[model samples]
Target: MREIDRLEDELSPLPESITRIRKLISTLELCHHKAERWVTNIIEAIGEGDTAKGLGTRTAGELHPAERDWRDACVALSAWCAGQPAASVEIKIGGRSASCLLSKLGERSALKEWQVQRLIERIREFIGWPRSMHHGDSVYVFMEECGADFEPPGDAECPEHYREHEEFWKQTMQTRIHDTVNGEAADFSLAVAIDVMFPCNWNFVGNLDIVLGAIGGELYAAQPLTVCARNICHVPIRERMQTVCRTLQCSLQNQRSENDVDSTLLELLGDVTAPQRWLVASLDKTIRLQLRL
Candidate 1:
């Protein structure tokens, strides 16, 4: 009944599963509430970031909690909605609700391993954890098409170079995509939309506020994520990192015990440029020395 009453009425501790179920309920409700408020904010403030007027209208100031709750909630919900019962595919956003750098590259894209690593870095940058919205996850990650495209800022290290590309980076950084979600590629732009679940293997969890606009864009967007190379992850950070370690030939294991690994740490291993790659190697060497100790 009432929250206080429920707390007071408890004769004994509830079963762990029940407690988790209650938590799941709370999380989903929170997700719904947050999403609603988020929508409300967008509606009230039509022009925020580098939007095309009322188009990419998300504002930059609002705080977006890590998507972990939604990710965990969806995973648990997926199970409940399935097996014991089943979650019918109520709705889906086929494509265009996502963004990709490699897909855009098709042919020019470098090694497949490089492409995969680049995407993994992007995931680590935006999504903070692993096993998000695992299978039955119920959190909705939204996408803004913003006409044909946009990418995060270049963030060149050189003071002069950074200044050179600074202006262009702003224009390019808008239109955040649910990096892992396979939103449809558009010949023409589509309106903003969101969807959280499908019968897919696993869903992307951490688009964060970082993924979306230049106009009403987020504060985090200005920073670069190593996963983003310069793109998202469901397969896993450790598993993927193991592969990257081999491909790139650097020792990068034990990065948070199979977690998404923090983006700040990931920045050290970034491959954004030839210099960035060199920095990753240098940093990895230093980290390895510490690891052996």
Candidate 2:
């Protein structure tokens, strides 16, 4: 019994790894079961023994394309769960080599090479592993292979009317600012101003509170907008220029402190003050002075 306890002590970490794998397997199995049930219902609806012309001849052993894909994925996941090694093995994460049970599972899984690689990536993500160049490369390659539609709009390719539309929005925002200054609308929040000006940007509306939080001021009341903008600085301004422009314009129009604007915008733009400075310079002198730019 003492020897058995010693073996159990040595394998203490193994149980957690096995539990994780089991949870994943259970999820996959549930999905597979649901898919199977759905496929069975569809086949039954089509009438198994019916020879209806439009319905087509129901084959006794045929599976729908979706069902086939789900089945294959289930099979692959099952094989992986069943083949977990009893011991740890070497694995690379974020370019650093480490010995872990998951790495052992990766090495031992009966899944194909590509399947194993994908599984390892998922496990690494689940374990909160630091991202490496390999992770970036893998994501880039996958996006490319999957034809991800994330290409930035080029200046040359932009519609001729885009400038006109932007100008219209700018004028509208300026008018709104004037109204706010004249006490026409005392309740105008910066979030509302941004949303109104950059109507095309989805994130601005959803992440208004997040953006406001990043700015850091008495604007905490703007928290009930939509999406969290916590890591929006990491997002490319070029991808969402309308929102970016609106934010800068709104900040300037409201005479928000340079320090506050800088703190937030810097996260989105490495040099926070640069965009605001440029924006101020481009605007009328009256507007520039009002913003203390």
Clash count for each candidate, listed in order shown: 26, 4
lDDT, each prediction: 0.28, 0.30
Residue-level lDDT for 67 in candidate 1: 46
Question: Tens digits of per-residue lDDT for model 2 on 173-222?
Answer: 22211112222222333322333222112243233223223222323333
lDDT per residue for candidate 1 within 1-293, as digits (tens), equals 24334442452354443333233223221112242332222212211211122212448433344344333333332332233222322322222222221122223212322222223333333333353434333222222222212321234222342244444322333334332222333211111211122111122222222222211223223333212111122222324334333333321332433344334334333333332233233323322232221
Alpha carbon lDDT at 79, candidate 2 = 44
TM-score for candidate 2, residues paired by index: 0.19
Off by over 4 Å in 2: 1-86, 90-114, 117-144, 149-250, 257-293
Give the Å shift of residue 288 in candidate 2: 23
